[model samples]
Target: MGVKNRIFKYYFPQKAVDLKQKRRGNCNGIVLMYHEVLEDSIDIPAWTIVKRSNFEWQMKYLRNNFDVVTMDEATKRVCGLSEGQRPFAVVTFDDGYKGNFNNVLPVMNKLSLPFVVYVATKAVSDSSIYWYDKIIGLLDKRDDLFISIEGDDIPIRKSHSNSKRWSLMQKALSKLKSMSASERDIEVKKILDENDARSFSSRIGMLSASDLGAMSKHQLVTIGNHTHGHELLDQISGLEIYNTINKANCLIESWTGIKPKHFAYPNGNYSENVLDALSAFGFSTLVTTKPGIWDGSRSLMEIPRLGIGRFETKSQFKARLAGFL
Candidate 1:
């Protein structure tokens, strides 16, 4: 281990112990949200794109100290349906990144850890990559390019290196958020072509049907629907949003022989209509990217999660997981 990692591990145990003492007898569980577990850094710079070594360490720590459970178990505990004195944890990955199948699943299998994977169903069946991935890949290829959205000219700086790309992409994507769907698609296509980069589809490949099938068969994994297309629920009509979620659940059930009972909002943002739609579809629980501990009083449809990323050191990881910081 490096000096920093060694130091983190040395100091983390005391921090965990301190937190445990302060919140004595609090029956709370943590739902950790991870996107992609990668061996090498990708174009995106979010801390949640955790390195393989760090991810392994985090999992090892959890295995050694906590009783990691599935989303189903966490839901049951939150609903007062399970008898348990031991603390619980649930691991989930959003967006169905191919990396989840290629890299994360093997580690999980080796440890016999159970996890939940929420997928964007349309992306799974199609060759398209998620829009966010496409944006980052385009920016990575060209530093001289300037993206103009809504009369705002945002310069793409060469100095914004790989480590800073996620911040830059967030700013750029925010600008496009105001555009009509057709207009945004046109602009994104042009940007990709100008830089000789493949659109999102060619950048981060989605999980194939076979990959989903294999993952479903694993006793350690559960699949959840993340909408047919990752549409912002608040912006679309109620019926449209319902259809998106319903289609995804139907597709997953056909593929896996199990209808998913859990749902995760796209972008971790939702509307009242969205929640009602999930309830109408018979969803027992829903998860969001917001950070906090679950104490069973929060809305089951909007349970929060602390998103883990690349910037988190081992100490920070432990602190967050232990609810110390």
Candidate 2:
């Protein structure tokens, strides 16, 4: 660990955390956001992939330290319809990664913990990979020194470590996220095909319909909609946002036999129209990528969540839950 982490791990005592929690009382709870959970041996070092061991530690910590609840129960707590222990924690996974089914479900099930998995429907049904993953794969496997997208040629660096490659991918994703979904797909496909990057299998691809079905059946798992195309609702037209969400809900209901009552904004982007569309669709709560505790002061439609994954150390995780980071 680095110097900062050393302090958080060895020096940041529990008494300090207790004081912080006590000072920040009456907050509704905290909702944690995660993406992929993989074994520690996995070579992919993306920010979204939390190693299985680390994930287990975090989940166990939540189970012991906080009242871990499902999305529905969290909503009830948000609305004062039900009561629960203070500093509630809600675990959620986004992008419907197969890791969630293969890795996360077993851990949560073993601990008898509840969580929400938001499925981006098209990826699940079409058996296709997420655009961001494709970008990472293409960049990591590229043989050329540089690649050209549209008319712009971006330099590719020879990296001694995964960190350098990840840096390149982050820059690429920043540009991609600004574009429309179709435009982003076109760019992603160009890079993947030109470099002959293979699509990922069940190891990293989105969950299959059967996977969602099986997971939803677990009493501790709650299936939620994450839009059909995983498009950024704030960037798209109102009609497109409505259609994507509506279509996703139908497909998810078909697979899980349960109509999803909650929705997570893809890329954590939303607008007034997006919120209105979700309300019209009868979604109970909407989760965003905004970081902070859900203190019941925010609208149910604008619920904030702290994104957690590989980048966070155990001490940092403790501090995050305690609202220190």
Candidate 3:
């Protein structure tokens, strides 16, 4: 094991014990969220990616020290059902990265652990890459681009680097949201071409239809809808949001031969209308990016999750998982 992995292994168990003690009777269960399981390098911001080694170490810790369960079982137990059940954890990944199938699933299989992956179905069919990836790639290559939003121009500076680009991208995307769909598409296309990101295909290595089908067959893996295009529901109309999520659910069902029961909001920011729309669609549970423990008494629509990413050390990982930080 590397230094980080060794350190994490040593501290993770103690952190879990401390968290368990802190929560006492109030501790329900933990819903762990992951994005990409990178082999050695994760190019994204530190807060958004976790290395494969760390992930494996974390899973091993769970296997040794906690009863890890599926999202459905954890939800049921939290809801006062499944009496006499022991404390457990649920593992979930968002944005169905191709890496999940390539890197995450193997580890999961080795550990015989159950996990849920929330996939953005639109990307499965699109040849182009996700816009966020394009943005990141652009920022990585060009440091001199000035992103203008509503007449305010922000130059990408080297000192702030990733943070500045992320903020600017958010502002730019918000501006795009205000435009009509066709207009937004035109604007995005222009941005991508200008950034020389047109050659980068987001779907180049993503999970194919067959891959999803095979994954769904595993009893340990459950698929969930993350929307058609992974749009931020709070920024879009209720009808658009509903259609996106519903479409993803349909596509996943067509591929997997099973209708997904769970939904995770893209970006995990939803308005009241989005929640109502989900309820209307007969969704039993939804996951959010907000961080907190799962209590049965909370709203089924606003489930919070602790995000794991590249910057997390083993100590930090344990601290976050144990609810210590």
RMSD of 2: 2.9
Per model, state how many residue pairs clash: 7, 0, 3
lDDT (CA) per prediction: 0.76, 0.80, 0.74
lDDT of 2 by residue, 113-184 (tens): 999999899988899977787766554343443556667776656553555556666777788788777887
**Candidate 3 lDDT, tens digit per residue, 1-325?**
3554556644656746765745544237778888777666545443345668878998997776557888888777788777433457889998887778888899999999999999898878773457655554555453465555445665666566554456665666667767766676776677766656655433224577878999999999999989989887887887888789889988999999989889898878788888877787777789998998888766878888888766566676776777765
Worst 10 residues of 2 by lDDT: 138-147
Candidate 2 overall Cα lDDT vs. reference?
0.80
Displacement of residue 168 (Cα, Å) in model 1 is 1.5
**Model 1: how large is the Cα RMSD against the reference?**
4.0
Off by over 4 Å in 3: 1-16, 19-22, 41-46, 83-86, 139-146, 151-187, 199-205
**TM-score, every prediction:** 0.87, 0.90, 0.82
Sort order, lDDT high to low = 2, 1, 3
Name the candidate that leads on TM-score: 2
